[model samples]
Target: MPRFAANLSMMFTEVPFMERFAAAAQAGFQAVEFLFPYDYPPATIREQLDKYGLTLALFNTSPGEVNAGEWGRSVLPGREQEAREDIDLALEYALALGCEQVHVMAGVVPQDADPEACRATFISNLRYAAERFAPHGKRVLVEALSPGVKPGYLFASQYQALAIVDEVDRANVFLQLDTFHAQKVDGNLSHLIREYAGRYVHVQVASLPDRNEPDDGEINYPWLFQLFDAVGYRGWIGCEYHPRTTTAAGLGWLAAWR
Candidate 1:
């Protein structure tokens, strides 16, 4: 069976943020992930993980001013310093929490922004993050966001994310293949797994359109899970989805899978 990580940010919202760790463990999850860990002290998060014996799968670099509609800032031109700072901060937290990977979120691009400039900035910042994380036995990951859902997001396709990872030219920098975004932008899910599994170090999933639990999505996750095993990807597949009902109630799909 594939190893799965519960996304605390999206999966266990029924409880308080700090309390989700135990909930995930009680749900029989051996690993967990979330969007950002900056809200609480690193030691506090670590306590939850130690208490539950759950591995930290992945979390994103700090997204600047999320309330201002900023999904990420790394890809925005002139924000390289801020992006680098975000990397350092994430590294600090990751070290303290024993997490081995961090996702570099590509912030939304303005309509008038130059695509080339954004790409260059993202590539440069990614290289910086990868270099900084490599010494600690950690990795930097980049993901392709679905275009319509997060308008103006820099990486809207797997190809784009792959190209950026290639350009970054760091062995520790890997693509975060978010299946929900892949289903939205690239439909050949099996072929994608076969061809690009080597490029990914982490994976996330949610049903398309609604971003719900994996069972009812257009993409058949069981087949994808088998394909992932066939392709030799032994990494954690994160359950990053919004619950249709209470978080615990919505976990029937995962329970059935288990």
Candidate 2:
């Protein structure tokens, strides 16, 4: 079966962080992932995962206001040191929670940042993360942010992911293609799936325009699920969408999704 995870970052906002972990477990998701577990303690997160028996699929390194100020601006060339240091902090959490991937957010391009240099920094930072986490059996997957998520984000296309993947060229390094983002930036979701399936380390979904449940989207998720089946993408599909209703009310999706 294709596993599922609740992206606690977007799905359980009304609950406390620890309660969100509990909620996801109660909802029957075997794993969970989130962005920036900065507001929570590592030991607490570790204990919650254990108590709930949920795997930590992914979590991000510290992001300095990328949601406001350059969201994820960590991969600029000059920011390599910062990126490494941030990942080091994340390492403690990753180890504690048994996290599998970290989103090395390549923030919006700096005014004077050379594109190549920024991309190089992104690759270097990924290499550092891969090396840092390999011994712990963890891999750092790069989540390419859509322009909507970060207006001037570095990677907005699978093509860009390919370019970076080619440059980085490491077994542990891979790409994450979110359906909403892909639909926003690239029209051919099925094509991207067929073409870059090998590059995909993770997958997420949401309705277009509204970023709601998959059932609310115009993207033909039934066919979308078929596409995943065709591609043999036997992996956990992360529910990383913003809820259209109260988080608990959004539980209606469970019946449909199940």
Which is the leading candidate under TM-score?
1
Q: Write the per-residue lDDT of candidate 2 for residues 174-199, one digit (tens) a residue.
A: 78878888888878888998988878
lDDT of 1 by residue, 160-199 (tens): 8898888899999998999999888988988888998789
Candidate 2 wrong stretches, greater than 4 Å: 65-68
Q: What is the TM-score of each candidate against the true structure?
A: 0.97, 0.93
**Which prediction has the highest lDDT against the true structure?**
1
lDDT at residue 252 of model 1 (Cα atoms): 79
- Residue pairs that clash (backbone atoms under 3 angstroms), model 1: 72-107
Please give the lDDT score for candidate 2: 0.79
